[model samples]
Target: MKHPTSYRTSIIGRTAGRLGVLTAACLTALAVAAPAEASTFSYPGHGVAVVHDRATTHADRAHPDQYRDSFAIHELGAVFGLGADNRATAVSAGCSASHPCRSIALSFQIVTMAGSHVRINATNLGRAVNEQCPGCQTLAGAYQFIVSTPAPFSLDAQARNQLAVIHHRLDALQTSNASIDDIKQRADALAAQVKTILDRAAAAAPKDREVNPLGTTGPSVTMHRHFDGPS
Candidate 1:
């Protein structure tokens, strides 16, 4: 793998020239298997592989001057997936209605998606995170990073089959002609087994999250990550 690139915060959403991370065949397989997830995080770059895009409005009672006004607009990416890229990126937007947005400092992490069950390259996901969004940026101290929210991407074929098998077992248990107590016993056993399986899957599954514990302290703020499409 190449040495990780340095990322700086920019109010204007832009991308430097990118190097290809995978061959055509590998990239094709990844495109088909990994679908866009719906969740996101802020202050990324820890263990997670993807950061879904999100936005939030924060008010700073102490330093309103740092922001255009008191409140600032923060745009963060969704958490990372296992088979995705290691370095995640997000932007920070200022509060001013008239001012343009900008990216944040320490905006990315350096990771290599190796040592996992799946091996999906992260080129496409990385590009999407850095280049796709427009007017993406926020003011200083608008976003917070407390912990990583694990957002798993679509399971590969084998993982899906494993899940399907568990579902089938649950269905069979529901239809079995047994006393409630007996069914409960059997179901309990099944649940234990399922937990074991899920644990393994979770270990192998492509997971993502952000890393920002002890974020800027203020009243708890609600952040919204928007990737739904044009208004």
Candidate 2:
């Protein structure tokens, strides 16, 4: 006696209610099992970070400098130098101009600098590598950088534009195996310098309150990041 559409709708509603109950129960169980101070949420796949390194294509024959710059491709200071100390040893003691350490399978990362105010961590991405350097102190891994700021701040239109430009340059670095020389040349031709752009962006931000606690305004901010990769 009931309409087909109405009967199907009733059945669908009941099924949905059952599914909702099941989902809630599973979540509650997971919450109990999870740690007390678990800081991160499971990624919902909105944004994904990838290591677009050229050296990976020719790992066995890649130069140390080439391998090093691959990681430095990400230019943000907020997300630079993650697993750097480990990477540095290989650069300084591992190889030199005379005794080149060929066949580098060095693991590198760029992480946010630790601060009392901010808790920084990274969501690691699995990028498998064959051990080309035997008995070497190394890690072969990648990461998507994460930062939790002390205070919540919104990006203004100007700030958003500046960030867009920075992202473009970083994308170029990631996609190309361009040498420092070629990069510099292109920048020179275009009259754009990475340091200058970053300095301008930093200047636009408020002065460090801690730097001048007594005064209303702080001193000029000088922010710099240098890549200390092998030559």
- TM-scores of the candidates in the order shown: 0.26, 0.30
Estimate, for each residue in 111-213, the C-alpha lDDT of model 1 and write its tens digit. 2122212223333111112233334432211111112123323334674465456445544542344543453455345444544543444455343323224
Candidate-wise lDDT, in order: 0.28, 0.27
lDDT of 2 by residue, 177-225 (tens): 4543454344233223433433354345443346445444421222222
Listed per candidate, the RMSD to the true structure in angstroms reads 21.9, 18.0
Q: What is the lDDT of candidate 2?
A: 0.27
Residue 131 Cα positional deviation in candidate 1, in Å, after optimal superposition: 60
